[model samples]
Target chain A: MQQRGRGRIAYPYIIWMAIFIVVPLILILFYSFTEGDIHNLKDLKFSVSSYKKVLEPIYLKVIGNSFVLAGISTLICLIIGYPVAMIIANTDVKHRNLLLMLFLVPIWMNFLLRTYAWMSLLSPNGLINRLLLWLGLPKIEIMPGKTAVLLGMVYNFLPFMVLPIYTVLSKIDKHVIEAANDLGGNSVITFIRVILPLSVPGIVSGITMVFLPAVSTFVISGLLGGGKTPLIGDLIEQQFLSSRDWHFGSSLSIILMIMILISMAVMSRIDKSPPEEERRKI
Target chain B: MSKNLIELKNLTKRYNDMTAVDSINLTIKENEFVTLLGPSGCGKTTTLRMIGGFEDPDEGEIFFEGKLLNDVPAYKRNINTVFQRYALFTHMNVYENVAFGLRVKKVSNDEIDRRVKRMLKMVDLAGFEKRNVDSLSGGQQQRVAIARALVNEPKVLLLDEPLGALDLKLRKEMQIELLDMQRSVGITFIYVTHDQEEALTMSDTVVVMNKGVIQQIGTPEDIYNEPINRFVADFIGESNIIEGVMLEDYKVSFDGLVLDCVDKGFALNEPVDIVIRPEDIRIVVNPDEGMIKGTVTSVVFKGVHYEMIIESDKREYLVQRTVMFPEGSVVGMNVQPADIQVMKRGDVPCSKEEEEG
Candidate 1:
């Protein structure tokens, strides 16, 4: 009886979830399976055309581009972020919090403002090119291209990768590392055999955190890509607002959700597998 | 056993302003099971870590088999440690955890498997090779830690209170098992623990430490029967310590009674501390026929004996025997001449301060 009363506190949250989350998802599902005026229930008839339209070659390319870009950005984040996390975790307690706070200070500002700042710095005749000219170097084109979008994704998502990995690295028992040293492992071997494998869960979560956001980010691609490198997110946005095609947009959203779910399932499987299996894979 | 395997000369380690291990000298022989026994913060673990190459001493030298090892890192040293918490790698299986040392040296897989299996069998963890380390019980994890350290077959093994986390019965069982393992392996074992009983049960030489200094180092029997100072006598077991004056060789006076004792080499009429073991004192049936007379204050039943507190004219005495003396009963206590141990008073000021603190 006590547990039941305590659980009653969650009723408001459950109602909130049903109204804000479940209802929208159900409407999207209904839109994805039927083609009609969504505002008029009389004309809303069951159909498979919206789902069939998602199989077109043009849409598939956009989805592939989204995966490829997100995958590359996540890989870069791991490569650069792992060492940064290790360095942060190994720092003395007096300075570790300061270093972590410095890393997170930029994130406290508005996301769009940070991206806009990057845009100003990377634009032609902007801060970077002006500095390059002042150094007597040739002018380079980075903004209004795929390179700028990739840079934006990496810059925005890098902290997501570092924080989880740092958390895991710091929580690892110092005795375990000492034991590795006692068992005749040098620093490099100890890191490879003990620390790296132990931080796999963090790496997995970091990948998910970076990849999910990067894939569906329409703002960065739109601002930096100059409407040239259209990703799945941009296509879905255009379908809803510009073309006024909610059915197709709803279908694309469902497909993207399914792809994310699949990737998450695969990531969790990797996380659950033993370190020996991971070593064998390497 | 005759050959000195490790020698520490004036080894000292200080952390900031506090000296954790003071300048001390010690020699550990080959095939000896030596235990560094002390209470927490006594620097026993610091000394062990210095020997293991985990911590470099701030002053002095550490020599292993006649070679200077002060600059050697822990991984480069030919020594392995079974950590106090059993520090088993949770991400690995039992087999992988035990085989880690061999794998680091790039040993052949067949050789690693054979040695790991044999070590597991010795620790009675056979058929547990594929099990995850986190799935094992605390005692089982301890055995794995032992097996992991022993698999390398190093010249010496450092165990920092390996059985400290186990239950009482399991700890007792592992103490015997560890003794057997040490004999079979025939390697010098340097163990550290705060548990005096464990140190006594398993070590050939017990080093008693207090306040970053060696209080005494001797066989368990010697340490128990002939502790060198007031600190050693008081720390080792239950004892009645009383201030007394040495009248001459073989004679001491305390509680208004002069008695014969075996200790000498002190200045005549010098004030000294006298230690009398509880069990060494005999309660006489007739109060008038004893050297010291007292009234029993309290009696407690301890599994194998009865402990009674007797209040004499000078102080209360804790006496242990097979017989129970009821409260308020008048009793007389008699002690053998050899049982009265005389020690120089206030040998170390830190321990005195510790007592007061």
Candidate 2:
């Protein structure tokens, strides 16, 4: 009877999630394969045309460009953030909390507010252009292109990259580092054998953090990419908002979800590829 | 080869406002297993760290085989340390962990393989090469740490409480294994531990320290049987300390009993502290015969011996004898004059006081 009561209490939260989350996901999935247009859904019609139309040459490039931007951003973040996280985690300091807080300062503000600030800085008379002009250098055009899109994405996404790497770095034992040194490893060798392998979990999390958002970022592309190239994110936004074609938008959303799962599957496979020895310690 | 493997001269370390290690001078000879024994915060680890070049002394010179190691970093020094926490690389497999030092020196891959295998075999971890370090038990992990340190073939292996993390049964087992490994390797080892039993069981020489100062340096027998002070005696083992006085050269007086103790060179009637080990005190259980009449207050049987608390002159003294004595047995205890250790208070060295027969 007591077990039944406890089970009843757990039922409501699960029921709430199923009603709110499961119902919408099922509706989206149902519309993804059915015939529809900008005006209204053509009922009693089932066709693969809606799914197939998501693959026009322009939309394909959008998907390709999104992957390039998010992938490059994630790679760069790994190179820059890993070292910074190591320095933060390994440093013996009295004011470590302050240093860490300084690293996380960008996270405290609203995401849209931060993006707006980036726009103000990257404009023609912004801080970067003015600095260049003051140095008697050419006023290079950096905004409203692939460069602006990448910069905006990186700026907004640095914290996600930093936090996971930091968590894994901090958890690694110092004794292991010393043991590496004791085993005849100098700084370079220690970093390779001890530090790098241990921080793999962080690296995986950081990559996922940067990769997922980089691929689906509609805001940075819309505000910075200047609509020169419609990204997969922009296409989905257009289907939902501009085109008012819920069926087509649902189809695009399903494709994005499928791509994410493929990437995640590839990642977990790569993580599992290294047998026990390579992964056991990492 | 130089006679001494490592030497520290006037070594001192300070942390902001606190002095962790005061000026210390000592020579550790080659192939000798020496221990820096002290209680917590007694500069033993600081001393070991300075030796390993993990820490720099504020004012001192360190010599490794007559070479100055003043500006050398830990990597430059041919010394490996087994940290108290067994600092085995959590991310590396057992084989990779052992091969770390060889790989650091950029040894050939074949050589790294052979040497790592040999060292692992020496530590009795042959088939565990592919196992994750964290998956191993504490004792196995400790062996991996030892294997990692020893594979480097450093001139000196410094251990900071290598067995401190193990259970008592495992710790004792490791102590034996460590001593055997040290003998086989035939390298100078600078071991640091507060456990006097571990120190006494392994070291050829014991360096007792207290409050950032070297109190005494001698063999385990000397430090145990003839401690230089109350601190040395108390720190090493269970010892009874009694406040006494020096009546004349070679004579000390305790309570109303003037006893013949073999320590001297103080002025007449100078107050001194006398230390006697528990087992050294012989118990005489005759109804009418013994040195001083004492009633047995309590007896605690410890497998092979009885820890008896005897009360004489309103002062309780603990005595350990192998005989299984019943509770409340009236007995008299006597410690030989040679067993009585006389020491003065304050900062001072051991005096060569002559004893009068």
Candidate 3:
């Protein structure tokens, strides 16, 4: 009886997933294997042309560009986020909560609005250049280029990196750190040996959260890369919206889905270590 | 001349307006196993941290082998601590955790391997090196922590309630193991705990503390028999503490009866506290042979003895005897004059102090 009741309570979520998630994914798979759009499904003919097009040098270059830009943004976020997490985690309770709240306040706004906010700061004659010229410095051009897209991605996804790492760092036992000090490990050695290794799960999750969206994002690249440097996301969008090649777009979407699954598999593999009590029971 | 391994001269520590450790002086000799025994918030841990260089004293100096060491950081100090929760490195296996201190010192691989194996064998964890620390039980983790700290071969070892996490049976076993380890290592061990039995069983000297101050420092026998104040008497073990008037040297009055005791040097008619161990009172069958007559209100059969609460004319007394007595039965209680311990009244008069003895 209890099992049936639980099943009933989960009915809504199950139905929602089947309709909004499973059905669309199946439709995309079917479209990727066929030669035409799905509106006239009965007349569609099966072919492998879409898959072959994905291997062509033009599409491969776009995928490579996407990987490089996303990888750079993820690296920048990790380098900048880890220290911010450590500082917040190490502060006293009263100040730690306040600092974490301040870090999260910017993320409360819409991601699009926040990206536009960065655009205003980075554009040529925008707030940053105006301030620099007023201070007797030459105005520099960074917007409408690869730098702008990388900066926007990092700025938007930074909190995703910081929050997980902070949660892990804060949950670390203070006694463990003290034990390291007691064992004659100085600050640097203690961090490298104890703190960094323990924070691996959080770092892995942060990488997944940042890298996936950075690889498949269209808005940031469209606005900041200024139609010159097209990522895989832009190519898919162009194929589906302008060129009316739904099969090619579906193939790109399938490849993006595979990349996401691979990242998810990596995250789950690192998270597979059972908690201490459960391991003992086993 | 004797060697003093560590000395604290008027050491003090304060947090905000509350003084965690008051101005206190202590001397630890070479290779001595000393324990700080007290209840919670009694500054035992604060004092230990100061000795380990985890905290600095606000007002005086710490000396190591006649050299002042007030400014040295914890990593530079020649001491290691086994924390209360064991603090075993969860990311490392037992072998790696025990080898951490040696690796930090840049020891060679052969030497590290030899020392790690020897220490593990000393802790009776010889074949468990490859096991993850998290998979081990609480007692095993504690042993690994000991091996980790001892491998460094520090001049002193500090343990802060290291047995607080184990079961009762495991705690008892660990207590004996820890004492043996201390003796074999021949290093000064400064252990902190609130368990009087643990302190009495292991230490060469017990420093009793209360309310951020040192109450008394002596051997186990001295602490049990000659508690300088009422707090020491009540905190250390079970005691029937009662109020009394010191009539003169070697004479005291309580419960409308005067008794002769071994204490002296108090003013005539000075109000004082007296402690009598429960086991010291003898239960007699005949009222004529006993000093006080009472009826047994409650009786509980403990493992080795029967603890009975007797209500006399003046007050109630907790008496422990080997034989059982039925509840609501009339009984006679007798006490010897030598068993009556006299002490000075410490702090203010509280209700807990004025209860039945």
Candidate 4:
């Protein structure tokens, strides 16, 4: 009886999604073909010239750099986040809930605001540099560079990596771990062979998160990386803001969107693979 | 050579306030299968985990073949465990899961393959090497867990209720399978469970425990026939413990009846509990001939036999016999001198320690 109205209940959400997401995306696709600015373009002419402009080396270089930055940040996040998550998940029962909340709390902050906050703490006159100068340390020009961008990428994505990995680690039965030790697989061996492999789903989820956001984000690069080091997001934003070429920006956005879709498709393929089961026969 | 394969000397584990295992001193022999029998939270699993080096006893030293195991980590220990939840590798296929320990030890690929296959076949799971373990049945997963542990061929096999996850029929089947495997391998098995029947049926030695203390450790028959205290007699099987007074060295007065028991060194007029297994008491059809007269209050029809509860002097005593008695059969219950075993009241570690200074 309760299941009878399920489709009707979901009808409103579907209509709202079509109006907000699907229609806007279709408009973006259609706008990529429009020619010239509105004042000069009394009659709109549809053409593929905007797409040709997106294929230029300047735009492609930033896309490539975005991939490299996202890749590096993902690697660093996994290395740092996995162990922290593991310690939290497997440690004393009394403190686990608190640890989980602490890790999760940072995500509630606004993404753009957090990136700017890092800028204040990383600049030459920022607290971090001021501390180094006070300590009689060499002046470090660390802020407003590729390093800052990478750091921001990792910072924003660390929780995404940690939460999934922590969940998987917590679900791991300690009994299986004991069994591994009993079978002569010590700490290192057990972690590498059993724990690591079983946690691929979480790792993959983490990687996707850090990689996708880092690759597409302009806000961090603009605030911390400075305008000199262009990324795909910054390059796309420039076409609309400074260059005033809406069609070209739309084409670049389409390319970035396609890349995201491709990666998502690959992740879905992996996610559909076999579930874990340890077969015991008697 | 030291006959004992593993020994726990005054082992105790305390967690801030609660002591999980308290001074448990046990010895297991080479090639002998033993079961630590107790209810949940009774430190049986803690005891097994300590033996496997997964847990460290707070106040004891462990010895394996005369080698001290104190401070030894789990991996360095030469033991394998079949975990209660199977604990089979979730990510790896059955073959890889079984082959994992060998790979870690850098065994030759050919040899690892041979050993994994042999162990898998031994568990009756041939042709399942490539199949993902998650795709298998519960019993199949359990077999993989066993194969994974057994393939390593460690000195001792620690199983913490390995068969507890299975259905009743599967559990029974696995019991036979486990016994067969144990016989063939000749490896010492330290099985932990709360099941009395499983322990009685499979273990060469059974250790009964309750509330962080070992009650008795002996062969199945020894534990069954000569339970050291009231808990053991009650735990292993149903026992009618009657409150009595020790009239002499081996004589006790139980309610309006006096019976000769085989116990010594009790003070005169000392309060005691005489424990008698239901099967030990015999039922006679003639009400006048037996030592104690009673009427059948209820007759239970157990398959292949009948168990009757006898009521005499407002007290109930169970008497199990092959012959079925009618619902209202007026019968007599008697016991031979050899069958009536007696122990001091509240002698067991668990039940009688309610109020202590």
TM-score of each: 0.96, 0.93, 0.94, 0.93
Best-to-worst order by lDDT is: 1, 3, 4, 2
In the range A1-282, model 1's lDDT, one tens digit per residue, is: 999999999999999999999999999999998888888998999988988898999888889999999999999999999999999999999999999999999899888998999889989989999999999999889889888999999999999999999999999998899999988999999999999999999999999999999999999999988878899899899999999999999999999999999999999999997777325423
What is the DockQ for all candidates, taken in turn?
Answer: 0.57, 0.53, 0.49, 0.53
Candidate 1 local accuracy as lDDT? 0.91
Give model 1's docking category: medium
Which tens-of-lDDT digit does each residue in A1-282 have in candidate 4?
678688789889999999999998887787688886645666668889988887788777878888888889889999999999899988788999998888888789998888888999999899888999999998777678999988998899899889888888888888777767777777887887778877878887877877788888899888888876889898888887998877888888999999988988898777666543323321
> Candidate 3, TM-score vs. the true structure?
0.94
DockQ of model 1, rounded to 2 decimals: 0.57
Predicted candidate 3 versus true structure: per-residue lDDT over A102-159, tens digit per residue: 9999889998898888878888988999999999999878789999999999988999
Report the number of the highest-lDDT candidate. Answer: 1
DockQ-based CAPRI category assigned to the predicted complex of candidate 2: medium
User: Which stretches of model 2 miss by more than 4 angstroms?
Assistant: A1-12, A37-44, A130-136, A273-282, B347-357
Q: Give the deviation of candidate 4 from the true structure as CA RMSD.
A: 3.8
DockQ of candidate 2, scored on C-alphas against the true complex (2 decimals):
0.53
Ranking according to DockQ, highest score first:
1, 4, 2, 3
Across residues B228-273, which tens digit of lDDT does each residue of candidate 4 receive? 7788877777788877898898788887787887777999989877
What lDDT does model 3 reach?
0.89
- Listed per model in order, the count of residue pairs whose N, CA or C atoms clash below 3 Å is 0, 2, 0, 13
